[model samples]
Target: MDAGGVDLDARRNTNAGTRLISMASGTFNASIQRVKAWSFADAAKTSPTYDWYPMYGMAVSYSGSNVTSASGKSISSPIAASFVQNYRTQNFKRVLFEYIPDVKVMIDSLSDNHDALNSHVIHGVSNPGAWITFTGDSAIPPGTIKGQAEGDTKKYHIRADEKTGEFTFVLPEGNYLTAGNKIWIYAFLNGKETLTSTIVEDKTPPDKPILNAITDKDASFVGSAEANSSVTIYRVSDHSVLGTTKADAKGNFTLVLAASQKPLVPYLEYVAVAKDMAGNESVQSDAKTVQDTTPPSADAITQFIQVGSSFDLKAKMLVTNVRDNAGNDDDNLSYTLLKKPDIEVVGKSEAVVEIADKAGNKVSVSVPVFVKDQNSSVSKEAMLQAEDFMVKARELPKDETEWDAFILKQAKARAWGVPAGNDISDNIIVTNRGVFSEKAGTYTITLRVKDVEKTIQAVVIPGTLSIKKIPSDIQFGMQKIRSFEQRIKPQEETKVTVEDGRSEKTRWQLTAMLEAPFKINEEEKLPDSLVLASKNMDGNIRYTPINTQGTTPVFQKETASEGLTEIDLNPAGNTGLMLDLMPGNIRSGKVYQTKIVWTLENTP
Candidate 1:
């Protein structure tokens, strides 16, 4: 083709007929049209035989006016042919393409992760109509298929919301689910799957903590709880925290209280609580009460006894009185003698008493005792011939008072001995004069040695009772008998003395009576009676007439009268004897004589 015509003929075709056609729609531009050309063998002879030739050219339209051949040949009516586009590949470049993007699912946050549960509801956001599935470990599967037997492979499935694209899945209810269970979730839609969510199930709290019984003022609290858990001790009265600690791997814990922390109050209640690492709290353990450990005071127990007093060790226990801080009364306490005292002997001794409270706490106290008996007795003979009952050895007691007591007891018991450091000859004074009397009777001897006063009975037994002294004769002076009356009294030599040496007092009597009437001769007798006078206990003068019928009561003792007693008949003082003479009764120069009888009786 020429340059002008070649510019118009932009494309070429190799097909035999209907050469200008597109291989496929949209494979190339269709606005540019194609045509085939025809040629004459000899154009000089118009009528010569012609041959058809394939021509290549361009056209603006497939319609009548723009259609032509390379020679500008036009036909009034052209046959239209319909065809499709076609092409031949020569060289090409490579390309990579994708039809859809990946889909992701997000799981919602869980509310409770440590509560024991049989089933759980899972929520997430996903595309509509997307299926959500759950997978777990071989030991614990998520769930069985819906409407399927329980033996089926465990899995849980659900669909997203049709409008909101939100989905929920309920984990199957079974005992197989346990703490720390793992679950892998997947969301599938349009053959696309996302494995971006995984859940760890922990639905159990630690076991309740255990607390041991404790006492007041304990240094630490010891107990057991879940491994690696936190344990706390609380006072039950006010719910105050006493101590806290973390449990070891073996579930043992010891909470040491700080120095500033108050000690456990006695008789108070306490409890323990445990919390696990998963933020789960356990119930309180049983109450561990605090007990009282203080015992009754040893100093408060006291015993008192005077020296030389007797005591019975087994009859009465010591330490009966004591004070306790725990409000224990005497009835609730027990007394035990740890050491017995020597009470039989009269000396100082020590005793130990243990006092115990209701809680079994005990305290010991030492008590001192002094033993003595104030009343004692001794015996001896009156006058001489008393036996010596005391030792004269120089050995003495450590205490001067005790030595004095020992010496005094011996002297009193045996009725003869001198006190230590006193004159040996003083025995005469002690036995005969001091505490002892010559008169027969029982006498009480009292001696004070330091804090102790002792009394001893010194008994004196009499040897005999007899008349010790009496006048040998009584002389009445010569007198003349007259016609008138006359009276004569005895001389000064008339008297009688009696001594009693008996241990007991006895009654006796002394009587004086005329043996015969006084007479100048047997025919002439003086008055046949004589008068004796004496003083009574009230110091009044009393007179008795002596007669021969029955003995007149001259001096009679109605009761016991000990020691020496004397009676005087001399014409002196308030006692004397008198003789009366009547008218013409006496003869001049005539001798008058009479025998006086004195009788002594051992009765009133």
Candidate 2:
């Protein structure tokens, strides 16, 4: 073992034989092994420098005869069930603990009734500074709260660790330090300090709650506080508590409000109060007035409205004061129209109108209305008047035929009704047949007219008819055609006047003939070339001579209806005839006269 970094194996093997060469009686002689004289005079036997230790304790071990395990201890027999370990020497029992110096302390085993946290026994703890008592209850009683008051067991400090979530305290000495005390033992490593936390026992009641409002809804009174509570409502006057109602999750409650026992009433008021879970009562809510007393009025419908199918549904009615008694206090007033007798018919249907006020009180009235269809009816009697019954004609034949009912000018005679439904008044047809009485008496006829739906009768009353004529005398006035130039000019001839016939169907015509052709007063005669001729009202001429003396047709009804319709003196050449003279035929100066008979007859 020199300091040369070389192996010193010489002293390891055959160690006894190499100490010298002999084994004497038991050991070597001390005289031979000793150095008799030693000197420490100049040099001191002190270690020269510091160096690392050889770390000689062998941590690696194996199981063998005496050393049977890695813990380097003799293997003992299997733990005897009845053997007392160290009992003969010591009375205190042993407890194994896993302890890390200044780091952690865990109780792994216990000898007595010591309760540890997390089911771990606080084994081998010494000189405890704080102790913990864990009970089933979170509330620590007044006398039980240690170290909180003077004259109390101040050394027995108890606290619940808010950070570590543990109960720790200083265990009192003597009987208080006994096992099974449900206590925690904290080693005296650090001094005690104050700790604060929640307390389970709450003695003070909750704060005064607020009372918001109370209202009435139909048979119940309702209120709200927006809190979780139970409420009770009371009649204010009698101070009688009404039925209680639990608030909903949202704290809205409804209390049953009884109806008034008697009909006669001023409204009643009720008050309410709420109570929370802590038995704290809130102030009384506002007094709420509640009533639904008034029955709907105007139920006796005296007069009914008249309605037709043609009427607009929006039309207002004034038949009765149809509304509820509480209408002013209610939210709204509305009316519904229903068919009375529950029958839906077009004509004369009863309208059961129910009117409701906001309080849900309703009254129905039966209204009688004339519910006719939109179609209107017209009778033929309204179409005929007095004018339609009579005709003032001249003395006609007693055997006169019936005037055609179709020929009657309805536009001029018949009186018409208003246009209704499919009845076009302008297109109404009134058929009748009658002749005017000869002496102005009753003129009877049945007139039927069909409208949109049905046929009806109309009375054609007697109406008057008349006629007159003038200027019956037609004269071909005297004219002098002695000179040849005078004969060339034309003159206005004779014209006969006629009026419309009394019977509108009467037609007339004219025919003419001459005894001699242009005779001069029946003495001197003109030549055949100067014959008698007449021009029609239309400016047409015809001549006739004695040699050709056949009657010539003059004015005919078929040719022109002028004379038959009205006056023949129309401005459009319907009045006068023209006399035209030929120049080659001459006549001496003479006055002339002629006759024209216009026969008025019922021809057309």
Candidate 3:
């Protein structure tokens, strides 16, 4: 090779003693014989100051055993060839040499246990374009410099970047490291092994926490779980965290729900989750209900009461009209009467009713009782003197000072008014408002005490006597003319009413007489009528005729104590006008009329 950018090829053939020579650039194939030194003439410079040439060289040489020098001076089996450029006394060689070196692969980074459970990546530096492999649970042996050894060790392979010596091996999905288990990562690239080991923390989650009952009235949520575990209370309604706390050494945890930034919802379901120190979260606990804390309400009662009267105010009766929440039952309610009502008085009284539920909630109300005195009455007298009157009654409440706490009103008539200033003298009430004189009639008085009322009557006997409701004119029906005397009765019955208001010691008599005789015409006349009256004796009717002289007694009273008397002149075959009929004595077509006079006399 020479600086003129040319290569030299020398070869010797022994069969025909042939030898060939050629000039080449770059590499040369040569079999030299008896040659020790070689050189290339430097090319002349086109300009001494502006000369230039490209560097050229060969990295290979040819040596054959058939080569022999003609002088029999044998050349070495291999000879040196060189290319040099000499210009202006400077020598330059154009050739580079390279050799294979041992591979140096190292693992620089690996995922920790926590990260290995998620994103697992192995990082290392290696020769460019070199093959890389990762293994778990087993490390590549030291000083391993050749192809991979045949073994049961786990492995993963990857190719590094052609331009960069950096390599990475990522674990496939669903591959993870167990908690608290030590795992080794082995990276092999180009038969060079590098490994690193890490102890994986806990990865298996603890069991779900056991949650306690949560009531709306409670301030915290309490439960038990793994020791040193973090508990989070979540509102199932929204999956939001209500509060959080850490479990003690005894696996007991309490989360203060009242301390939460946002209020927790009532009557909603909630659950708890426990997170271990290794960041492992457990499944949610059983759902718990947040109970409500509202209490019940009751209504008031009013009852009308009287002395000796009993009222049943039991607990069930008190809660009959109560309003309560669904969480409370009517049977769970009880009542306590603070005080018994006073029913003996004729006034209002209060009964304090206090009702409570099983949850220790209470409601209070006041029940009013309208109390009235027991009813009382006084005996009424059919007749009384003009002096002061006394009343006899029953069921009257005792009075210390006065027993006249009663009202008086006229029952039948208001012929007189009671004085406003009337007073009771010797237990007798002064009932007259005018000049003192008792009227001769039955008078009724109403007695009142608070809300009770009673009635009594007082009759002031009069010194005078009178008769009322005199009997009307009597009439006899048509009689048949007969030879024998026949008795005929009147067509209608007559009635008479009498009253005797005289003193108790006085006697009275009543009499009746015929005022006019029966006459039909100037020339014809009816028989004299016999006026008869009937009286009841032992349930039997007895008829007796009265004298026409107006002196015979028809009805009479022995004394004023008899009060009022009445008599009926029933003509049914017994009483009323009786007539004697004879043949041709009465006319058939004639109408007879008669009149009767009644008199009353206060005698003996």
Query: Ten-residue segment with the worst summed lDDT in candidate 3?
Result: 70-79
Angstrom error of the Cα, residue 224, model 1: value is: 1.8
Separately for all candidates shown, the number of backbone clashes (residues 3 or more apart, or on different chains) is 15, 14, 6
- Write one digit per residue (lDDT tens) for candidate 1, span 560-597: 56578886667466477876667776778877878777
Give Cα distance to truth, residue 344, candidate 3, Å: 28
Per-model lDDT: 0.54, 0.37, 0.51
Number of the candidate with higher lDDT, 2 or 3: 3
Best by TM-score: 1
The segments of candidate 1 whose C-alpha lies over 4 angstroms from its true place after superposition are 1-104, 110-119, 136-156, 175-182, 198-203, 215-220, 256-265, 291-295, 300-303, 307-346, 349-356, 360-366, 370-604
lDDT (10s digit) by residue, model 2, range 1-604: 1121321122233333232111222211111010111112211323211111111111222222111111111111221111112111011111111121131223332222123232222223222333333332222212254542223343433443434534433233221222223333332222222222221221222223333333233556666753677788777889987778777887777765556622312246767777766555667777766655454555433221223224334212523654443343324566666544222332333456666666566666665443222222224323222223234333333553534333233223333332221223344344543443444444444433443222222233322222344455444456655434322212333334544433333344544454455545656544343333456588675554322255444455643332223434212342224344555454556544444333444345
lDDT of 3 by residue, 1-604 (tens): 2221232222221233322331232234222111222212222322222122111122222233221221111111111211211111111111111222234566543333443423255566766765555444332222222333233254346666678878765555545545444555444432234555656446567788999997766778899998999999998989988878999999999887555432334467999999998788989999998664545577655555565677657644533477544334556666788766787754456666777766566777766555544332212211111222432222122452232333132221111111111222223342433321243545555433222234455544444456677655666666666777676766676677776544444767777676655667656755454645455777574545544555557666664564467766553655554665657677777787666677787777
Q: After superposing candidate 3 on the true structure, give the runs of residues whose Cα lies further than 4 Å from its correct spot.
A: 1-116, 119-297, 300-478, 483-505, 511-530, 533-553, 560-577, 580-585, 589-604
Using lDDT as the measure, which candidate wins? Answer: 1
Between the candidate structures 2 and 3, which one is better when assessed by TM-score?
A: 3
